[model samples]
Target chain A: MASTKTEGARRKAGRRKKEDKASTADLLLDATSELMVERNSAEVTFADIAEHSGLNPALIRYHFGSKAGLFMALLERDAGGTFHNLETLVAADMPADQKLRHHVFGVIKTYWRYPYMNRLVAALSLESDSEAARFIAERFTRTLSEAQRRILEQGEREGLFRKIDPTLFYFSVIGSCDHLFTARHSLKFAFGVEEIDDDLRIRYSDHVASILLDSVMV
Target chain B: MASTKTEGARRKAGRRKKEDKASTADLLLDATSELMVERNSAEVTFADIAEHSGLNPALIRYHFGSKAGLFMALLERDAGGTFHNLETLVAADMPADQKLRHHVFGVIKTYWRYPYMNRLVAALSLESDSEAARFIAERFTRTLSEAQRRILEQGEREGLFRKIDPTLFYFSVIGSCDHLFTARHSLKFAFGVEEIDDDLRIRYSDHVASILLDSVMV
Candidate 1:
C-alpha cells in the first residue's frame, strides 16, 4: 500500500498543473463536471474525483465533505455565473428581443461549458430536500423566470412581442437549450453527427434562438 | 436463511396478481419501467425490481439476464408502440399538418405514460455498449427522426408548411414535451404546481402542437 501510494504520488507529481491556477476546490469541481458528463452523476464516485483530479482523497473530504457537496458547489458556481450574466444583459441598453436572445445564448453557453448541468439540476431538484435543490430553485429557476417575465413584459409594452405565458414560454426556451446538451449524445446520434463541434453549438444556439423568438416576436 | 426465503415466498404468493394476468417477464418489465420513472434509471436496483414485482431474483436473472436487459425490453415495447402510432397517423388520409399534430401529441402521450423514457434513452445511449443502447438507436431514435422527416417534407409539399430543418425542429418539439415529463418534479416545484393532471397533459399537448405547427405552418 505504501509503494502504491508513493507511485500514485509520483505520477501526479509528473503531471503539469493547470495554467490558470485554479483552486483545489475548483479543480475538483471541474473534474466532477467532466465525470458527470462522461458517466453522469449517479455513476460518478469520490474515488473517481480523487483519481481524475490527482488530488488527495483527504483533500476532497476536507473541502467538500462528499461528492454531493462537490456537485452542489459546482452548480452554485455555474448557475450563479449564468444568473449574473443574465442580470448584466437585462441591465444593458439593448432592446427586449436582443436581451432575450442574449439571455438564451448565455444559457446555451453555460450548458455548453458544463454539459451535464441540466441533468444534474433536474436530478438534484427532484425529490430532494437538500440545500442544493433550494439554491437551484431560488438562485437559478426563480431568478431566471423573473428575468424572463420582465423581458416578456418589456417586449409586449414595446409592441415587439406577442402576449405569452412567461412560465410556459420560459420553460420552452430552457427546455429547448437544456435538452440539447442534456441529450447531446442522443441528439448527435439522431442528427448523424459524430460530435458536437463548435459549429454545431453555434448552429444549435441560432436554431433555438430563432425558434423561441419566432414563436413570440411580432 | 431458509426461514427468510420461506417468508419471502409466502408473501410473494399471497400478493394479489394482476387481473390481466401478465407473465413473469412482462411483470418484470412493467415493474422496472415503474421504478425507472419513480427513481430514474441510475437509482434502480435488482433488489428493487424483485421487491416491486414480487418476483424472485432468480426469475429475473433467468428471464432477462440482467436489469439492463429488462430496461431494453421496456424501451422496445414502448418505442414500438409509439412508432406504431406514428405509422398509423402517417398512413391516414389526414392532411400533413394534422398528421404532424397527431405525431406531437403521440410523443407527449408516450412520455406521459412512461415519464422516464427520455431520461432512460439519454442515459443508455450516452456511454453504453449494450444492446439496450443499440435498440434505442435503431428503433427509437432513427424511427422517430425518420417519421419527423416524412412529416416535414409532406407538410412542405402540401403547401402548409415553411421550410425547416427537420432535425432541429424535431428536437424542439421533443425537447418541449420530453422536458415537461422528464423534469416534471423540478418544473412542478418551479411553477408551484402540485401535479401534472390530465387537464395539464391536454394543455401541454396543445401547447407543444401549437408551438411546433406555428413554426412550420405557412
Candidate 2:
C-alpha cells in the first residue's frame, strides 16, 4: 500500500522532469483518474492516458497490466491513505467524540480532493463477483465500517453520543460529505452556479462536519 | 409526469394475459430497469431487454426512441413519483413539522424500493451537458431542491427546527437512504449478509428518519 502511494506521489512530483523520471506507472494511473473524473470511466482508454501524461502507449500495459488493473491500482493507493488513517484513528485511545469527528474530516476531505473515487467505488462495488471490488471491500469499506462501529459503540458506552445504527450512521456521514462532490452537476443546476467556488468549498466542508457532529452528539 | 405513472400502472394491471398484452411499452422499460439494476447500465442493451421481457426487438425502437431513451423514460417515471410528491407536500399549507416529516418518508420510502434509481440519477447527473441529464435537472432535481429549500426556511423561521444549509440537508437525506442500496455489495462483504432482510430495511428507514429529525429538531 505504501509502495503504491509513494509511487503515485513520486510520479506526481516528477512534474518538473516529466521525461527524466521514466517508467513511473503512477502517471498512467493519474491520467486515467483525470480522464475519468473529467469525463466517464467507460470512455477512457490507454491512448487517452498516453495523450494526457505524455507517456508511451506501451507503458500503460507494461505498468498496470490492463485497464481494470490501472484503476484498481489508483483505488488502492488512495484507499491506503483514507481507510488506513481511519483505522489508526479508531485504534487510538483518544476521546471517542474526537475520534469520530476526525474520522468524518478524513472521509470528507479525501472526497473533496478526489470526488471521482466515490464513482469508482460505486462502479466496482456493483460488480460483486469482481476480484477488484472484493479486494476493495476486504481492504477498505469493511475495514472502515468495523472501525466506525467500534467508535460508535465506545462513544455510546461513554455517554458521549447516542446509540447509533452503525451502518446508517456511516452512510449518513459519508453521504452528506460525498453529496457535494458526487452531486456537483445537479447542485450546479439547482444553485445556477457554473462551478463551486473556493468559499463554498470551505463552507461545504464545514457544513458537512457540523451536520455530523450535531446529528450524532447526544 | 402523472400521466406516465398512470399509463405505467394501467399497463402493469393488464397482467392477466401477459402474452396477449402485446407492445406494452412499460414492460420494455421494466425489462430494461431490471437488467440495469442487476448489472450496470452501460452493459445493458436492446437485445438484453428483449430477452428479459420476451418482447419483439423492433418494438423497442417503436416504443422508445433508443437505449438511452428507454432508461430516460424509466428515470422520468420514477422521478414523477418522488419529485411530484415532494412538490405536493411543500405546497400544502400545513404545519412545517408535519410536512417535513412526511417529506422524509417520501424521500426514503421511494429509494427503499428503487435502489437503482439512485445510481441512474448519479450517472445522469454527472453528465451535466447531456440532454437527458439536463432534462433531469430541470424536471426533477431543481424542482425538488426549491421545495426542500422552502421547507427548511419555513421550519427554521417558525422555530420548529434548526437552520440548515438546504442543499447539504437534502443531500444528507438522499445519501443516507441511497447508501445501503448502492453499496449493497460492500455492505454484503462487510457483514457477510447475502441480502438485506426486511428487518434491516425497516431499521434503515427508521434510522434515517431519526437521524434527520435529531439533527434538525431544535
DockQ of each: 0.35, 0.45
Candidate 2 chain B — worst ten consecutive residues by lDDT sum? Answer: B14-23
Clashes of 2: 0
In CAPRI terms, model 2 is classed as: acceptable
Which pairs, if any, clash in model 1?
A: none
Summarize candidate 2's per-residue lDDT along A142-209 as a digit string, tens digits.
77778888998888888888877777776666677677777777776666666666677667767666
List interface RMSDs for the candidates, in order. 2.1, 2.2
TM-score against truth, every candidate: 0.86, 0.82
Q: Looking at model 1, what is the TM-score of chain A? A: 0.83
Q: Fnat of candidate 1, please?
A: 0.39
Report the lDDT tens digits of candidate 1 across residue range A143-183: 88899999989899899988887777766777888776776
Let me know the DockQ for model 2.
0.45
